[model samples]
Target: MPRMKVLLISLAFVAIIGSLGAALYFMMKDSGDKPKSSHMARALAFRVGFSILLFVCILVAWKLGYLRPTGIPLQG
Candidate 1:
């Protein structure tokens, strides 16, 4: 990959993590011990955002060559 492309990809990954973290924080903060709907939404938002962050982290690691994937497959 070119230097410019790598830089752009890294920036994009960082942005994804930042935006998801902010959203999760706000969602949890806004939820109070009142409505069940709010609580559910908050929980869902946090989980989804967290998952996105994990994916972004993996992408970043792969881009920087810090993550190596093996061909081993595991069955659940």
Candidate 2:
């Protein structure tokens, strides 16, 4: 894989982790034993969006001939 693709994939992963951490932090920061549903929802949305973005990136890479399938060879 190229450097740009690697960088993007890593950044996406980091963003997803950050969102999750933020959600956890907000959930734990509340008093009165109430969870922050808004933060959790936003984090969830971010994660989903990032996942879709990653999927699109992969699809684009494949379409652009940057990715290829590798497996055992078949003989007939």
Error of 1 at 49 (Å): 0.5
* Model 1, residue pairs in steric clash: none
Report the C-alpha lDDT of model 1 over 1-76, residue by residue, as the tens digit.
4575568668766765665666566556754655645655665576577667767877897889866677788989
lDDT of 2 by residue, 1-76 (tens): 4787778888989998898888777777756553577777788788889889888988988899987666788988
Which predicted model would earn the best TM-score? 2
lDDT score for candidate 2 against the true structure: 0.81
lDDT against the true structure, each candidate: 0.66, 0.81
Candidate 2 wrongly placed segments (more than 4 Å): 33-35, 70-76
